[model samples]
Target: MPDITLLIVDDHPVVRDGLRGMFTSAPGFEVLAEAADGREAVALATGLRPDVILMDLRMPGGNGVEAITEIIARGLPSKILVLTTYDTDSDTIPAIEAGATGYLLKDAPRDELFTAVRAAAEGRTVLSPAIASRLVDRVRAPQGSTLSAREREVLRLVAKGTGNREIAAELFISQATVKTHLTHIYEKLGVNDRAAAVAAAYDRGILG
Candidate 1:
């Protein structure tokens, strides 16, 4: 089999160096390039088209999600494997929704990282244990999300800073109906209030 070409995208030089050393030393992998942030990653990826990108989530310029989104939009062949320190829903959900092939934490073992890269190179989905459980819970949640059209309309209005009464007026529905939709939205998004719901919706791709 051909060596799996890789682009390491991370803000920390030390972390990038470590990953470079590890992957370069390992057989069946080739380190194609290194990028300091998402912008650099995208530029390098556009040119190099590596087999896999080991990407970090948070960076000074252009976050990992945006880079993943852009790369997917451009139809780049590289499979994105997010290697980040964050595992929160706020982080993992967006990266996955943005078309990452895998999500692995910084604390993952070297062997596991290598295995994940191989799987990602083949377009398989890989997620850390914690992230996998979170997705499972969301899938098994009681109110089975898959929002109705009217409910989605309410959420869009809510995201745009519209009040319940205003949403009711805009949708030609009563305030009580708006409240019901908000409650379902909160349950589906696993958030308590409006702001959290909006944020979670954006993170999970429930809303744009």
Candidate 2:
């Protein structure tokens, strides 16, 4: 496999410089580009086609969400991992909805950040442990049957953002059943994936 190329997006020079320095000593990771704002990030990402992006949630000139959306709409092959200081549910959900494959805190230890970058390169979703509980709490909340009892159960696991295989074992259902349920839930909620479904569930008052 090719070395993982990263595009760092943040408005702060210190943050960008620190990230660049970290990656400088980290193997298998390269800083392909750097941008001070979202628009610059998007433009550089488009032209450079880096393998991964370390995006900040809050930035001027379109923000990380806007960059993610633009990159996805353009069908760029790079994956996005949010690297921000914000740990609130608001920042978390929107980042996912905007097509981020991973959410990470900026203050994470160097080892964790390295691991997360490797995981993101391999197309795995990574979430900081601190915000993982919020997903679990949302799953535990009582809600109406926007989905069937079984479907609701599936969606609850989904709201917690568990992978299909994890959901299958947790629910004692086959992977096929998990996919079928996911398809139905997406159709019902007008979403396309765990991220969009989570967003829809929140927006439609299906979850807390």
Candidate 3:
């Protein structure tokens, strides 16, 4: 098989250099280019059309999630693989939802990273062990038990004594949506009202 070509995207020059060196030294992989941010990643991916993109989630000019969304939107063939230090729901979920083919942490072993990149190039879903476990736990959680990122946001607002109207305004969502989120929260927490939900959230350590 031909070597898998890659575009390494990260804001830090050191990280990019390290990734480029790692891939170039490995067999069956080629580093086509390096980008400093999401916008640059998008531009390079569009032009080079590499087999895979190693993306870092946080950057100044643009973010990895935004770049993944745009690349998918523009019908680019490059598969995105998130390589970041964040494994939290907020970071992992959005990157996956935004069309990343895989999610791996920066601390992943060199072999694991290589395997993930190869799998991504093949259009296979790849996730680091930590991310995979979190996803599985969410799926196995009882009905309405696992709060989505948005639901967590709504719950946090509720805990702060923010009314539905205020939450809607703050989150840039409709009041109806806020209400819907509350309903889900109630069901998940096995509470009938907002107050109980807030207490349950606190008990479950969903809110800090």
Candidate 4:
């Protein structure tokens, strides 16, 4: 295997030290640099151009998601591998969407960590088994909506530029009932007006 240089990014000093120690003592790996948080990680990554970055998701400074976004946006060459303790939807989804090459928990075994890093360096997508299982479950499970069928109908009518009274007549309901449905639609979609509600619905694929 060829030499793969790395930048270790974590807010904790001990974690950084431990990662550096392990990678440096191993063959075919070079610990090129380390950063305390996301902001420092971005700066070092831009300058050092390491083969891979072992990034932490949460930190006191700019979090890992933002750094990963910025790095990918700037077309940086180094692949990012998220090495955080968080595996929830809020954490993993954004980091993966932000262009992280891999996601691995800090509790991952030492060999698994090495394997993930190597895979990340080769531009492969890696996720811990638990993380992968959660993602699969989320995909396979049904997404229950907070909006009712009638509310969705109202929103669809709103998207089609139908007036309240017209919608009421078409649905054979009173104008007051149509207005009430609109109010419920606005609340469920978290918007204030019909136009915003329509836009939100379309954005969430409820209108499309």
Candidate 5:
């Protein structure tokens, strides 16, 4: 297996060092870089191109959300895993919205953290078990609005990168109906574009 190189992004020196130690001690994982704040995180991540980035949610000079947005917008290949103390539903949704592939608490056990990092490196998502129900709730409740079952099916295909006609063929629905469902999905998710909708779906854990 290839080594999983990680970038640690946290404002606290102690936290960065501690995580670095944990990752280094774990077999097949390596600490590639450390950044004290979001800007530094972006710079180091851009330069070092680590396989995964452990990002703290709160920090100075750009913040984790903005950093994730910037990194993804710039087409960085690294996947971001948010390592934070905040576990509120509100916090969870936005961090995922910001392009985090995984979320874990600061107090997560070493075994869990290692597992999460490994899953993230392998292009799988990881969420803290503590907030798993909250994620399901967020998707189900969805700010007092919901997608129809059919619309959701269409969105799932869209999330998988299928075009309207492809979705139509796959679901045995008309292309026009597929477009209609996409429109409803866009309205419900408050996204103006396909990529935005896909991002929202993944953020809400509606799509893996």
Candidate 6:
């Protein structure tokens, strides 16, 4: 088989250099180019059309999520693999939602990273163990107990001590709508009230 082609995107030069060197020395992989941020990554991807894009989330120019979304929108052939330091739901969920083929942490072993890249190039979903567990937990709730994104948003605000009226205003929904969301949250979390709902969310790792 031909070597898998890659575009490495990261804001830090040292990281870029290290990734380029690692892939260059590895078998069955080719570093097509290096990009400093999302914008450059998009531009390079457009021109090179590499087999895989190794992306970092936080950057000065543009973000990995934006790049992934745009690449998918433009229907680029390159598969995106997120290699970031952040594993939080806020970071991992959006990247996956934006069309990343895989999510891996920066601390991953070199062999694991290589395997993830290869899997991404083949259009397979690849997630690090931590990210995989989080996604599973997010969807593995009992029947009728999974929280929707909107419900999670409401619960997050409630965890911060935001009142129903305040959450309504912040979310641009009616207080009645906020109440409906809260009711669902309470049911899903198996709680009786706001305080208990918040506590349950945290305990379930849904809040964090």
Per lDDT, the best of the predicted structures is 3
> Across residues 159-192, which tens digit of lDDT does each residue of candidate 6 receive?
9999989999999999999998887787566678
Please write out the lDDT profile of model 4 over residues 40-101, one tens digit for every residue.
99999999999999999889889999999999988999999999988866688889989999
Query: 1 or 3, which is superior by TM-score?
Result: 3
The alpha-carbon lDDT assigned to residue 97 of candidate 6 equals: 93
Which should have the higher TM-score, number 4 or number 5?
Answer: 4
Candidate 2 least-lDDT 10 residues: 137-146
lDDT tens per residue, model 2, 1-208: 6679999999999999999999978778889989988899889998999989999989877798888989898999898999999876557777888799899999899999999989998899999998777656555744333467787788788888789999999999899999998876775665677788888777777776
Which ranges of candidate 2 are over 4 A from the true structure? Answer: 142-208
**Alpha-carbon RMSD to native, per candidate:** 9.4, 13.2, 8.7, 9.3, 13.5, 9.1
Give the per-residue lDDT of model 1 (tens digit) for 1-208.
9999999999999999999999999999999999999999999999999999999999999899999999999999999999998876668878999999999999999999999999999999999998899788776854325677888888888889999999999899899999988887775666789998878777777786
Q: Which ten residues in a row have the lowest lDDT in candidate 5?
A: 138-147
Which parts of model 5 are misplaced by more than 4 Å? Answer: 142-208
What digit string (tens of lDDT, one per residue) describes model 3 on residues 1-208? 9999999999999999999999999999999999999999999999999999999999999998999999999999999999999887668888999999999999999998998998999999999988999889876885446789999999988888999999999999999999988877876666799888888887778887
List TM-score per model, in order.
Answer: 0.71, 0.68, 0.72, 0.70, 0.67, 0.71
Q: Is candidate 1 or candidate 5 better by lDDT?
A: 1
At residue 156, candidate 6 shows an lDDT of 88
User: Largest TM-score belongs to which candidate?
Assistant: 3
Q: Which residue ranges in model 1 land beyond 4 Å of their true spot?
A: 142-208
What is the per-residue lDDT of model 5 for residues 1-208, given as tens digits with 9 covering 90 to 100? 8889999999999998898888788789989889988899899998999999999988977789889989998899999999999886556777898788999999999988888998998889899988787678657777414667787788778777788888989989899988877776776677888899888888887776
Minimal lDDT window, size 10, model 3 = 138-147
lDDT of 2 at 95: 81
Give the higher-lDDT candidate: 2 or 6.
6
